[model samples]
Target: MQIPVVLLFLGLLTVPGRSQNAATEQNSATDGANAGEVEEEDPFYKSPVNKLAAAVSNFGYDLYRQQSSRTATANVLLSPFSLATALSGLSLGAGERTEDVISRALFYDLLNKAEVHNTYKDLLTSVTGPEKSMKSASRIILEKRLRVKPGFHSQLEKSYKMRLRALSGNTQLDLQEINNWVRQQTKGRIMRFMKDMPTDVSILLAGAAYFKGTWKTKFDTKKTALQDFHLDEDRTVKVSMMSDPKAILRYGFDSELNCKIAQLPLTEGISAMFFLPTKVTQNMTLIEESLTSEFVHDVDKELKTVHAVLSLPKLKLNYEEALDSTIKETRLQSLFTSPDFTKISAKPIKLSHVQHKAILELSEDGERSTPNPGVNAARLTFPIEYHVDRPFLLVLRDDTTGTLLFIGKILDPRSV
Candidate 1:
């Protein structure tokens, strides 16, 4: 299948008890923090399931925060401690079940929707002593679960079944509602729920993902400049390259096969590596054929260090993907059928609407709206190195898990 990847794919960081204390761990790497460097300490790094979870798109992704405009009240309560423990699985399944087929192929399908909620409720029993923030979160999850009826297909129906307005403009989404809901739920952790929502939104669209992560050792903004990025040898694209003097280094290779792998580390013993063919973007089959957990973790311990410059085209992608096929192929298929869902999904819910509306105001409401609003309009166009004119791949790795969280190959930029 010709997999169409969105450019500018972003991810959210989930922080627990102690924030990600990203003090550079490696002595060889930089000792101090850079301008935009964000210290991210994530316990999910230790989870095997999550290692593959982010990369595996087979399962449905719901952008649910403990609290939000998401009006559903779940009957099941998830204990904070258990939830945290459960989430640790994310890092564990990294390389092995990271693939769509492997990740979604198996599941806890035997459990009915109610059973799922009860299990979550049982886990909530472990939330005896959480901070007030954590307790409030628990209550919200219970409410969210109550709203998750198997019969419910679309979120509006599940939570606000009777509240949808057919006259609602496809483009006019109450962004504030979504944002406020998310901010409260995530405790201001994940911001900007979605930069843009697809206009072709439809039913079965119960969730959206809006995540942003910063490197622990951020590159100095001063060093960031226009660099030549090669999409293909003949096609030279100009892009932004965030460079620093030092970083975690590792030598990776696809022995007896053809691929490129590099262990790029994060602070606090966390790191991520990129694996591709010596020739990427040119012959993508090598990337497709040689991708696996063994392929991912089988980093060549002994390899040469090749000094090179890296330039990544600044890209933002807004994807309009249809998850129907993917969902049916995965474990959620029966949710729509008579045999499995007939009992709970008593409502014949055909996706009436699942449109996502996102807006990029460019400028805050009533500020002079001009490409170059200042007297420096002449100087504005002089430094236009941020133009993204090609395709690229983005992967977010959690060092604790040694897994790639989000993976997307962007061939288009306007979507963002």
Candidate 2:
């Protein structure tokens, strides 16, 4: 079989939260402080998950920036956390220059050697562990003929909680099995994830994340309507737009970056943030430049809860890309060329292909838009109107763990 490896990162954020009346009291107009609101401290920030999250998101941002440079007029999205987890599993079989390259590329070289894999073990377990909010899984697949080394096998089973699949020579059967696994992992949000099986495949690394959450403040569908989305300064297209007239969310502005930022809550301690340009033609460079882990943490701390009128295009997106150039750009060139995998097999082997696929679907489904029972609405404030009618960057994060679940740029929501 050809060495056609696939890294499928599926992030399914399903909004199914129980309807709750949002706080009707007007928020104080303070910049970073409210009279009695105290920010909750998250323990995961100093944990290995945070470090891993940082490294992975940084890699994803780097890849996004590079891809945007070449395809400046197209949409881009990927789950860096998924890519990192998949690669870390791949690293278990690598040694010598190959291991070093993967380590450096993921910035794992900066972490403690003894703790890295184990930390990943903890991270994976926590993420995929039983939670009402999200579901996640990762796997490494190999052909049945490839003999697994004893030491590698033990570590793989123990630390990674990996479910190994031995592919049979039958192409159709293999495709069905892979698709079944994908469907099971993603809770059926994704079906027929793999179009076809590659005839020449040696190993495949896959990671998936599924999240189902309810908006703390649901968008008023009664107010949602077809709105003009500026694809470019001169071009426009119509798309379903979600709106919340009395929306209350964490808000901030970065004058130096020339962008408006807002954080909307989702059930189970997750949040979706938007980075919108101040001008129609302003590139996302500054916002992209501000994607470091430290920067995000700072934003969370500095932003204040405020009332606002928010509007955004409802997004339904599916993205896939071959990473031949991304891997090289990220300086993991050794893997594509000469590197050691003695731990995995006795025969000389090297990576032949790397690919990623992602999917995102968002809407105000299965939730009530009207207020619960008989809650009375407080007098409205002169809310700042934040409309996302143009290209913007979005980051979905788990507030409890500071984990970035999804990140992407929507150049055109009308384009599937």
Candidate 3:
């Protein structure tokens, strides 16, 4: 089966509070004082879009950590770019004080804040371009009767390409509309987005995305069979595992993380990075905490290309969560109670809840043609063994723009 992925995100913001300045003024002043000194730019952050992508990707890592910590035993999957996009677009509608809260949460404090939205337009185009096979859409929803400021509306549309929605007060109709919009954005890949309408919504941010990937090397269908997947030291489950005796992949062993890292190429300039712990029932907290865009990039560069006797599970997973509590646990707690969105509307508003859902599938589907010429030319030696039989972490990244499309921790394939 083809590997299809879907992600949907919604953030609900409602009623009044005064805006308070974030505590970054002292630091900002210090940085400003030192700005006169000329310094070489870091290659990673040299471009505006790259800088913005790194900041948001870092936020994605933090979001994944928080969600993973909450559900320690269960699988955790998130397409945080969608959530980050929604929040970034909503920041345009925020007053200075409230905007700082969002800015800090998204790590925009580290970026040239003035060009963020504009750079995001470029980043969006690059990641969701036709060649990428990814479709993404975001929107802002308002209360039934709330009037949006013309300036905020225009800026949001111009930069974020998002439409504003005013609730009609009919719960079912509003719910239907939101779901339909999600379906339309994902080309019918995602059906129902929300089960019910949230009450007292003053403003809402919504985003959806869909992606399908084909592996560079296809696994033989005949080799796929039910195999034992170790869940823990004492537990195991049978899952359909795809095997390839001679798989060419980039490999690395992280002594610090005590995990094997493998990089597999996918079509459309995307790559899947997997981190398999050294043993079953090992604590993954260390590896989870170590995840960052820079670190992953370093690992990506340091990995070695080699032949591997590989075995991977055929996985189809779905996840849905209301991330209000998770967001509260982060640095963004104040948004739930006290936030100023006067720019969006004169009336006061604060964030209420965040909802997220994602679906991912991976199977033995790819080009039936011969492997890459490099793989064919390599002399056979002692091929390393890389089996994903235990719990593992996965990251799907867009190579061209360095955008994180998805992150997942698979504990039990059967559970999904």
Candidate 4:
């Protein structure tokens, strides 16, 4: 059941920071009245978003493992949602074999075919729609000359709400144009992302996300100072450490995973969870292995909010990676070497590269919220000491839909 498909070069990028949605800032000004309208959601346990979330999470972990093996010493970050969204759009033009391959790779086979695409359509609209808390978007780029099937074009535009671009033949101009579009979309947080256009390119699919999440409870900037960040037990570098004595946080220790997990809420529907290894030299292999949709859901269910003196490094990072090996690990092997994308274009095409780049800038923002009188205050006894001074895994998620926006291991924030 081989499907005919084109060669794909998938590139992903992200910029996360302390500021609000830059892409939507202008829109909010023009559409101020509707900006405050609330978004509706189904119950978390019953929603199909959870199913897709699990699939993306598994794919993300698999991809992270591949990248980790290659760059063990460097920081790792990947946006599974971004990659999956792009791939799903590409799948619209795929023939039977190609479609099957993408379906298996993306865990789409587990869901009813009719439900999968439409659910993704809904998810994309909600995440990238008006009144978004973070700035994020994904799209597919094809050579201008290629004749895209009308059905594929209509579905891509209507369902995915993706903007398709035609390469202008001028490599430098096209490169500049691509970078400019990304810059405009991400509100200039990331610029000049593509250095040079690939000469052999037939089709390229990419996704980018930019988020500057403000903590619900702000950290004191005055208390932030340089402190030792352990790269390993033998190595330590000074980094700006942000501390709050009465930081209210959800805390849990996973005995089976052998890691301490803490969750901090962000404004809107987003939340960030950190997994710190008990030993300074310990890496994220175990935690990476344990990441699954149900496991993360269970972790949150088990975690209880507590009073803690939290000390965390002020993180600003930029990371890039290639995803060929990771995609190869999935069921879509033939796609890398030989496959037909006749539906996309009459010309023969094969994938050459799959790459990702991300930038995250996190800091204390806004006035601190006072703790409530009940559970938050009661848990203040002998406050837990959760200092993230070493290598750890951090996940940013949409608490409403249970979607994972970004996941990565911070080996050395000092490097970026």
lDDT of 2 at 45: 49
Against the reference, the lDDT scores of all candidates come to 0.30, 0.67, 0.78, 0.70
lDDT of 1 by residue, 1-416 (tens): 11112121111111111101111121112333354444442344233333332222112111111111122211111111211222222112122223122223322221232233233332233221232212112111111112234332332233221222221333435444454554554456435554453443322232323323333334456766767655555766555555533322333334333444444433333343444344424543334333332223323223223322333333334332333443344343442242222222233332222222121111011112222122221112222121223443334333333333334444332333
- Models sorted by lDDT, best on top: 3, 4, 2, 1
Write candidate 3's Cα lDDT for 71-179 as tens digits: 9999988888888998999999888988998998888987889999999989988887655567665667788878778998899888878778889999999999999
How many residue pairs clash per model?
48, 5, 0, 9
Q: Which pairs clash (backbone N, Cα, C closer than 3 Å) in model 2?
A: 1-200, 1-201, 2-200, 2-201, 17-214
Candidate 4's TM-score reads: 0.85
- TM-score for every candidate vs. truth? 0.46, 0.81, 0.88, 0.85
The predictions' CA RMSDs to the true structure, in order, are 16.7, 11.4, 9.4, 12.5
Best candidate according to lDDT = 3
Residue 121 lDDT, candidate 1, scale 0-100? 32
Cα lDDT, model 1, residue 253: 38
lDDT of 4 by residue, 3-96 (tens): 1121211110011111122113224434654777443322564678666765655566566667776777777877677777878888877778
TM-score for model 2? 0.81
RMSD of 4: 12.5
Report the Cα lDDT for candidate 2.
Answer: 0.67
